[model samples]
Target: CQPGFFKASASGEMCEPCPAHTERLGSGALLCPCTDGFYRAPNDPPTGPCSGLPSAPRDLVATTTQLSAGKLLLSWTPPEDTGGRTDITYSVECRRCEGAACQPCGEKIRYEPASAGLTDTKVSVSELDAHLNYTFTVEAHSGVTQFAAQGTPRADRPPSTSALTTSLHYTDPPKVTSMRVDERTSNSLSLSWAVSPRPRAQPRPIRYELTYRKKDDNLDVTMYTVLILEKSSVQINDLAPGTAYLFRVQALSSEGTPGGSSMEDEYETLPEAHLTQNNTAVIFGAAVGGAAMLFIVVVVLLVRKRRRNSHTRQGPEDAYFSSSEQLKPLKTYVDPHTYEDPNTAVLKFASEIHPSHITKQKVIGAGEFGEVYRGILKAPGRKEVAVAIKTLKPGYSEKQRQDFLSEASIMGQFSHQNIIRLEGVVTKFKHAMIVTEYMENGALDKYLRDHDGEMSSFQLVGMLRGIAAGMKYLSDMSYVHRDLAARNILVNNNLECKVSDFGLSRVLEDDPEGTYTTSGGKIPIRWTAPEAIAYRKFTSASDVWSFGIVMWEVMAFGERPYWDMSNHEVMKAINEAFRLPAPMDCPSAVYQLMLQCWLQDRSKRPRFPDIVSLLDKLLRSPDSLKTIADFDPRVSIRLPSTSGSDGSPFRSVSEWLESIKMSQYSENFTCAGVVTMDQVLQMKNEDIKNIGVRLPGHLKRIAYSILGLKDQTSTLSVFAV
Candidate 1:
C-alpha cells in the first residue's frame, strides 16, 4: 500500500497507502500512494512496484541443424526472471519461410508437451512438402503472460524430387517379315526376318517390337514383347511344341508412328511325335517297316541272282544262317549292330555251356528290364562262384527283345569293376541273365546307412577311387553309364564299390560324333544336367554331371539330391544359376570338384579322365579328409526320461530336477566335456543338498558372496518365486 493516504476504497484498485515522506493532502487524490525509494510531487501520479523486466533467454539453440524426415527441431533455456516470478515455460513456433513475415505457423504435424516444468525448448513439424524450406521461432511464457522479446528464427530444408519413377520411355511395335519354326531335334526355334530400308533423307529413329500370343487363348494377352534396334533375327526356346501360336510385330519411330511396311504373320507348331503315344508308335513302326521291306526285296533279288553269282561268291563260310547251324551266335552278335543294314549277313551261335550248369538262387531284385537272382556257376577247374543272373521280363515285345539284345551286346563290350559283366545267356526261354560277381551289400546308400559312421574318409576315398577307375575304364572303352547313381552302385563286404545297371547305359555305336534318338522316360532328373533336362540329349558330359550328384550322395551319407524341392522348382533354381551347397560332411576341395562337374555348359565340364586325375590327387592328400568327426549321428541328445518322478539316469540329481522343471540338462555334466567353474556357482546350496553334492569350501564361500547369501541359509528363498 502506498503511504500517501490511509487504507480506503476497498472496492477500488487505486492505492490508499502513502509514502512515509509524502502524504496525500486531498481526499480526492488522482493517484493513490508513493513508494519510499522515490519522491512524488503533489501533481505527480502514484505508481506501484515496477514489474521486473521479463528476463531474456540466456541460451536458445536448434537441436538439429540439418533437419530431415519432414520436420525441424529446436530447444532453448528458460528466462532468468523465473526466480521472482513463476518459472518460465517455452513455446516453439515454426514458419515455412524466414523472417518476421513468417508469423505464427499452425501445427504442421504434431506438437509434444513437457509434463515436467517447461524448461523444454524442442519442437518439430511434418506434413510439409519434401525439399521445402522452413523456419522456426521460440519464446518464453509465465502463466498467461508472454515475454516481450522473440528469439531469432532458424531455417532448414529437406531433400528435393523425392518420388521414385519406374519406367523408361522408348519407341514402338516391331515388324516381322518371315516366321519359320524348325522341327529339328533341338527344342529351340530360330526366327529371322529382313528389315525394311529407311527413307534416303533421314532414317527416322526407329525401333522394333515383337509380340507373341498363345494360339490356345482367345483373350488379348501377349505372352512376350521385345524391342530390338535394327536386328532382324531372334531365337525362342523353352516352349512346348504342338502349342499353336500367333505372332505380331510393328515398327515405331521417334515421332510415334506405327505400322510402316511391316507385316504380321501367324503359324501353327508341329505336333510333337515324341510326346504323343500313338504318334511315337506310328513313327517307330514306319521306320521299322520301311527298313524291313527294303531288306526283304533285296534278299529276294539276291536269291534269284544266287546261281548267276555262284562262281563270284565261291565261299560256304559266307552262307546264310538258315542253311548253317554254327551261325546262330554270330547272328545274335551281329543283329543289334547290323539290324538296319539290308546287305549285312547275321548268324547266331549256341554257346556250349548248358543252362543246367548255372544254378539259380532266389530272386534278389527287379527293375524295368528284368529280375536279377543269386546263382552258382560251375566253371571248369574253378571253385563254385556266386553270380547275379539278369533275366528278361515276360511281356517284352519282339522289338523290345531286339533292343534288349542290343543293350546286352553293348554291355558285353565293357569289362570293368564299374560295369556289370555278362557271363552267359539262357536263350531257350527267350531270357538272358547277366551273371556278375555277387556283392554282399546291394547298394552304396543302404550300405553306408547300415554301417552308421564307421567308414572313415580314407575308406570312402578308396571306394570313390574304385568308381572313378571303373568309369575311366568304361570311358576308354567308349561306353557311358547314363544311369550313374548311388542306387545303381553295389558294394562288396570289403567296401569296394561297383557301378551296375547297364540297361540304360550305352556304347557309342557311332564314332561318338553322331547323335541317336532315345526312347524317353521320366529321366533321373535329380542327377541330370540342365541341357539333358531341357533337350533330352545325353552325352558323356551329362553322365559326368550325374556322377557328381552321386558323389554328393556318398559324401553326405546318402541324402537325396535336391531334397524337399519339387522337380519344377529344382529346375527353376538351377536355371537361375543356383548350385547345391556341399553336404555338411563334404570337404571343401571335394565340393569344389563336384561343382566343376556341374558346370552349366557341357563343354566346360570336366572329362572323366580329368575327374580321375583330380580324385587321385585328393586321395593322396591325407589332410583333405580333415572334416570334424564330432558330428556323429548316434550321439543324439537324451530327452528327459518320462518314466518316473526320479531324476534321469543320464543326468545328476540337480540336472534331473532341472529337467523335470523344463530347464536344459547336459548328459555330460560330470564328464570333462561339460563341467565348468562358472556353472558350479549358479547352482544353489539347497539344490546341492538335494543332489547330495557340494563344492569345495573356498568355492562355496565365493558362491555365497556372489549370491549375497549367508553361508548358513537353509532354504533358497532368495531365488523362490
Candidate 2:
C-alpha cells in the first residue's frame, strides 16, 4: 500500500486507502493518522481526516529590556492547541503610535532582529522613536510583512495591537553655526562647522549631520545625509567632476529638531579624471593609449569631463546658423573642431521664453528635480499650444538650476516626430522652466496597464514600431539611450509613442567618457545587457537589450519584467543564460525580435535600423503574428531550480507547470484568472491561447497535463481540492 493507504485487517490481501487529510507512513499500519496541523477527536472514526488549522501561540509577552532604551524583547510559550502539528512559523508586526492614531512602523524606522523564518517564540526588537508610542504583535503566519504596511494583502490571521508609551524625551535643538567649506577636490569636499550651545548640557545627547547637493543633479535630486556623531569637520567623497555643489551641516537634537547652517557657496568641483561611459566613443586623430583625445572643438563636446550622465553634447553643430538654429532644423550634419560652452550652446539653440509666456494649469506629474505642470505655451509669433512645463523646485542651488536646463541643450537639437519635442526654455528669469509638448497619455507602461486588453496585438506592434523608429533616429545621430524602458516612453492622445528622458543618454562620440566602474554606472540592471552590466560598456547594443524589455512590458500590458525576482536574482539568471519568457499573446515574430535584442553577443544583436525595418516588415505582413511562438522543454532544461516531477514538493497548477518545465506561464494563468485545479482542468486549446500561452509547445504540454491529471484523479478529487 502507498502512504495514503493502510491495512485494516490482520490478514487482509489488500490495504485500504486513507480518507482526505489523513495518511499512513511505512505501510502495514492498522489505522491511518491525521495530517500535520490537524486533529482527531476521542470518538471520531479511526480513518477520518483532520480538518482543523493550527491555533495561535500561547501567552505572547512583550517587554522593553534594559539592555537598550528602545530595544524590545518578546517571549511566548507553545500553543495550548497546536492542532497536533510541529511545523509552525510566526510573523510579527511593529507599529508606532501617536495617541489613538497609530500607523505601521516602516521597515526603515524599526529594526527587526529576527530572521524571516522565525520558528522561535522569543524575539528581540529594537524599537523606534523617542516621544512616539510603539506596539508589537505576534501571530501564526506563512510569511512575514503581509499587511506589514499599507497596500499589502490582508492576512487570514487577525492582528492584535497592544503597545506602551515611550519614556524617552528631548529638548530644544542645538545651534549649528559658522558652517563653511574648508577644502575641495575633484571628487571630495572637506567641510567644518561650529555648534553653538551644544546639547551635551541636556540629558539627551545631540549629533551633527552633514549633507551636500550638486549644482548639476544626479538622478536623485534630494540631498544625501551623512551622520556625524558630534564631529565638527568631515569629508564628503564620490562627488562628480567639473560640477558645482553646496554643503550644509545640522546639529539635530534627540527631538529631531534641525539646527542647520546656511547653504554654502557654489564652489566649482575640479576636473581630474575622465571616467565616463560613452556609447559613441570615436577616437578621432588621437594617439592610441595616449592623452590626445581631450581636445575641444568650437561646435563639439570633445572634452571628456568625468560626470555621470555628463552635461555634454557631441553634435554636428549648426555653426553657420548660430543665431537662427532654433528657428529651423539644421539641414546638414557637420562636426566642427571646437568646444563651445554648454551654457552658450543652450543660449544658441534652446529658445529662451519669458516666464509670462507660460500659464500653469494643474500639476500633471513630476521629474527627478521638480514638479511638472500641464500648461499653455504662447510664444510671440506662434499659436497657443498646450505644453508640459517643468519648473525648478524652490531653494535650488545655481548648479542644480544649470543641470535642470542642460537637458534642454540636448532636447533642442533633436527634430523628430517620435522624440519628445522641446517647445522652448526659460532660464534667465527667477522661475527656471523647461517646456515641452504635452503628452496626454503620459508614460507608456502606466497607459498600457490602464488600457490593458483594450488594444489588439496589431496596434501594440504599431506602438513598438514607433519606438523603434525613434530609436533608429537617435542611433543614426550617434546618441545612446541607456535607460530605454516602457516608463521612459511617452504617448500622446493620438497613441503616438515618443522616446523621452535623457538622464542616462550618452554621447556617441570620439573617445567616450574614458573612465568607468565595472558596476555599470547608473544603467538599470534588469533592462541592461550582460556586457554593459558587468563591464560598464554602454553601446547601441545595450540600448537594444533595453528595447527588448520594453517590448515585453508592452506585450504583458505593463507587467513587471522578471516578475517579483530581485536584481541579484535577475543578474544571476541572465548570467546563467536565462531570458524572460514570452508574454501571453505576444506575436511569435515580435518575441523572436526580443530574443534577438537580448542576444549574448552585442555584435550579433540587431541594429536599431534593422529593428525598425523588421518592425515595418511585420506591420506590412499581419500573418507573421498568427504563428504564435512556443517554448521547447529542451530549451528550458537550464532554467533555475527546475527538476523532474518524481519528487516534487507541490502538485498544484503552478506546480504542474514547473514539473512540465513551463512555470513562466504561472503569471499568464494568474492574469487570466485561472487559479484553481478546476480552472486548469476546464481549460482547452483555445482557452490556453486566450490566457496568453503563446508557446505552441507550452499549449500542448498544458493540454496534455490537464488530461493526464483529470484521468489520474478520475473525478478531479485527487490533489484537486
Candidate 3:
C-alpha cells in the first residue's frame, strides 16, 4: 500500500478515528481508509499520519444576490481537505445571522456533495424574504467528524431591490404601445403595457395613466383620461379616429412610488381602418376569420360616407351583437348593474294596466314572467271569444315593463298556424297582461308524455314539420327565438305545436341576426350553441343549434341531451364537438337534418327552408322512420331483402312465375305489381265470387309478414261479412 494508506482486509474495514475532523478506514496494521468529506492535498507529506480533514470548512462566506422575482441565490466552495483521503463529500449550511458562537444553523441550511467538477461551486436559495439580511455558513465533515473552514464567519447580504417603483415619473415619458379603434361610434381604444422589473426590496404592481393628445397640435397639454391602478390594460374613449396621438407610461413601486420614466413608445392613433376584429388579430384569425373578412369588405365601402353622418344607425345593432359575446374580464369585480327579476317586472306591469275590457280565468301555465290563464270576453255586442291572459308579477320597474312590452310587440307580429298568437297587451296595470290564443295541452314535453308514444312516426313528423314551418316563418320576418326548446313550444288539443315565450326572442327588423341577452338575462347554456356559450354572440345559426336540441328532446320524449353535465364540462365537450345521439324512432334522414343544424361550423348549418323540406319528405314516407329504429349502432345492420325472386321466402311464388313468363324480361320490380293483403281485401265482391280465390291462413300470415305489418300481439283473421 502507499506509505501511510492501506486496506485493513478483504472485509469492509472500519474507519479509524483521527483528530477533530480527520478519519480513515483501516484493516489489520494498515491505517483506516480515509473518510469522505475531505481530500488529501498532493503537497502533504507521504509519511504524515492521517489528520483531521485539513480544516474542512465549518463556515463558508456567501452573499445572497437578488435575481429576477426577488430571490436570493447563495453559492460557496467545497471543504478544503478530505481528512488526508482522496474520497471526499462536502455539505453547505446556512443561518439567519453570522456572529461568534452562532449555533448550528437550523434546518434552513441545505448540504450537497461536491461530486461533479467543483470548479466554481454555486447554489441558489429561492423564495427568500425581500430586502432582508441573511447569514449562511458551510460545514464540511470527514466521515463522522465535522470541521469548520477558515473563512470570515459573517456573510452579510440582502436580497436585491427592484429599480421599478410604483409612481409615474419619466426620465423619458411613457408612450402608447399601439392604437386602434374599438367601436367607431364610441371612438374608444384600449391600451396595454409591458410592466418593468420590480426591485426585491419593494415589489410594485403595474399601473397605467392613459394620456392622449390631438395629432394636429404639438403641445405638452396631454389630457389624462383614465387611471388604471393595478393592471397592464386600459381603455380610453372620446377620441376622434384617423387622428394622430402620442402616449407614455411610467412604472410604479408597491409603496406608490413612481419609477423613472421608460422610453416613450411613439404610436399614432390608427384611423377607423386599423381595428382588427375584437382588437385581437390572433383571436380574429382563429374565431372570426369569415365574419372579419365580410365585415372588412363592407366597412371599407361604407367608411367614405360614414364621416358625413356622425349619427351611426348601425351602432345599436352592432353594439348589441358585439356586447353579447363572451368577453373575459381581465380581473374579477362585482358589477353593480346586475340583471333584475324579469317575472316581478312583468307582474308589476300587470298591476299598472287599468283595462276597460279585461278578463282573467283559471291559470293555464306558470312561466318566469308570471301565470297564463284562459280567458274569454264578449265585448258590448260582439260574440264571445277565447283568449289567453298572461299576467306579470308585481315589482317590475318602468324599464322592465317597456322591455316586456317590446317583446310583446314582436310576438304580436306573428300570425302563422304553428306560431302562438299574441292579441294585445295591457300596460296600464301595476303588472302587464298579454292576451293570446290558448292551447289545451300546454307544453310539447307534457303533451308528448301524455300520449305514451302513441303518436305515430308520421304524426311526430307532422308536428316537427309544423315547428319547422313556424321557424321558417319567423326567419322570414327576421325574428330569432333565442330560447327555442320543447318547454317553450305549446301543443293544442289538435296536437298542433306552436312556438311561444317571446321573453327571450328578438325581431331583427332594425337589428342584426344574432343572439342578445334581454333584460331577463341569458338562457341556460346547456341548450345554447357553442359560439353563443363561448362569446355570448348569437345568430340564426345559434338558434338553429338550439332547435336541434329541441328536436332531440321531442324525439327522445323529453330526455335531456348529455344529462347532468355541469356547464364547464359541457363547454369542454362542445368545444370538442361532442354531439347528442339520434333518438329512438328518429329517421336517419331527419336526424341527419338535425345534425346539419347542429354542425360545429355554424356556416355549414342548414337554413329553416331546407329543414322544412327535409322534414316534409320524411313525413311523406312514414315507414322510413320505422326503418331508422331497426338500425343498431352496436351491430352492423343485416336486414334480409325481400326483393329477389328465387322461390325463397323473399319472393312470392306467383310473382316469381309472372316475372319469369314475361317475354320482355325486366330485372326491376314495379311498385304496381307488388300487392299487400290489404289490397286483396279491397277486391270487389262480385270479382271475388267469380274468381273463387281464398287465401289460406298460412298464406295470409306470409302476406302479412311481407307487408311488414306482422305484429306480435295481434292475430290475423279473415272477416266474415
- Positional deviation of residue 499's Cα in model 1 after best superposition, in angstroms: 1.7
Quantify all predictions' global Cα lDDT against the true fold.
Answer: 0.53, 0.66, 0.52
Best by lDDT: 2
lDDT of 2 by residue, 1-721 (tens): 6666787677747777787667657766778776643455544566665544445666777665422124556777665554444555776777677768988887544333352457877775653445556666666643222322233234633342222344334344556767766888888877776666632335555676565566444331233344555667777778787777756566765534345444444566678875454543435313433443343342245333433224344222222122231321112211111225556757855788988889999898867678999999887887899999988899988767766777787677566668999889888888889899999999999998777666768779988998998887776555667778898899997577999886422321122232133443454666888888787777777899999999999987886677545567678888877787776667889999999999887767887879999997886566787777774322212122323475322346687687555677899898888887667878889989998877564576567656555454332231122
* Candidate 1 per-residue C-alpha lDDT over 1-721 given as tens digits, one digit per residue, 9 for 90 to 100: 4334544445566555543434365654545443222233233334332122234555555443111123334455556554234545655545553333544345444343322234654543333433223554455554323211221112221111111111112222334455554442334555666555443335445565555655555332213434454555666676567665555455655533334334445555555664446987889988988999999999999987886677576552233112322211110112235446311211131132357778988998775567778889887776788887767788887655655555555555444445655565555454654556788788897776555445555556667777877776665433556677888789875456887766543332222222233466456667788888788767667888888888877875665566545566567877887666665455667778788888887767777778888887765564776753332111111122234354213224345324222122333245423254345546665644444334342233223332431221321221111
**lDDT: which is higher, 1 or 3?**
1
Q: Which residue runs does candidate 1 get wrong by more than 4 Å?
A: 1-353, 505-519, 627-721
**Candidate with more favorable, higher lDDT: 1 or 2:** 2
Evaluated with TM-score, which candidate comes out highest?
A: 2
- Report per-prediction Cα RMSD to one decimal: 31.6, 26.1, 34.3
lDDT of 3 by residue, 383-411 (tens): 66778887767887666555656556556
Which 10 successive residues of model 1 have the least lDDT summed?
157-166
* Model 3: lDDT of residue 58: 27
The 10-residue segment with the lowest total lDDT in model 2: 328-337
